[model samples]
Target: MFVKICSKSELPEGGVFRFDPETAEKAIVVCNEGGEYYAIGDKCSHGNWSLAEGLLENCHLECVLHGSSFNLKTGWPDKRPATKPVKVFTVKVEGDDILVDIESGVLLEKPDA
Candidate 1:
């Protein structure tokens, strides 16, 4: 099921927005760039750090704690210290609401911490 995250206005282009919808298993980091939105596991696989706190350069989200980087689109890590991939959710825009469906097309459960 899809859950409303937030208004599209709250998510600006070229930035990241963290949302915790009622249906979410945990907080999710939503990336907004060029009128597109992407959702992925919020917590980092390597250090348990919040991925929203990391920097978003293009499709890569860099972990601030250990300099690990993950590709937002595929949840693939581009550097050392993070071997496991994260769970990615599908994002859809319905009117003014940004909806995320974790159960629709999400990746398998994240690796153990």
Candidate 2:
């Protein structure tokens, strides 16, 4: 089931809302751009830094620890230092609420060799 992460008003345009759920140790962030909302893991795959402290432009999330970049849509790292991809959660906007399905679980998987 989806959980209400934050409200549409809480996240400013081109800004991010970092969510630390009371039940989960994992950190997630909701990014808003031009009224579009995207969710991704807050930890950087490179050095495990907080992506919430990193730079965000358009749909690109740059790691604060390293210069690695990830696609907000796919969570795939676009640079070095971060070979693994971060998790991207599904977000839905209903009226004034922004909900996320943390239970549905969005994780990175290894490719079959």
Q: What 10-residue stretch in candidate 1 is worst by lDDT?
A: 104-113
Q: Write the per-residue lDDT of candidate 2 for residues 1-113, one digit (tens) a residue.
A: 68888877788888888888762347887888677888888888778577878777868888877789777887878779898888889899888899987765476664443
lDDT of 1 by residue, 26-108 (tens): 77888886678988888877876888888788788888998888777788787879888777889999999889986654555
Q: Output the TM-score of candidate 2.
A: 0.85
Clashes (backbone N, CA, C under 3 Å), per candidate, total: 0, 0
Clashing pairs in 2: none
- In angstroms, give how far residue 26 of model 2 lies from its true place: 1.2
Report the lDDT of model 1 for residue 52. 89
Error of 2 at 92 (Å): 0.6
TM values, all candidates: 0.84, 0.85
RMSD of 2: 3.0
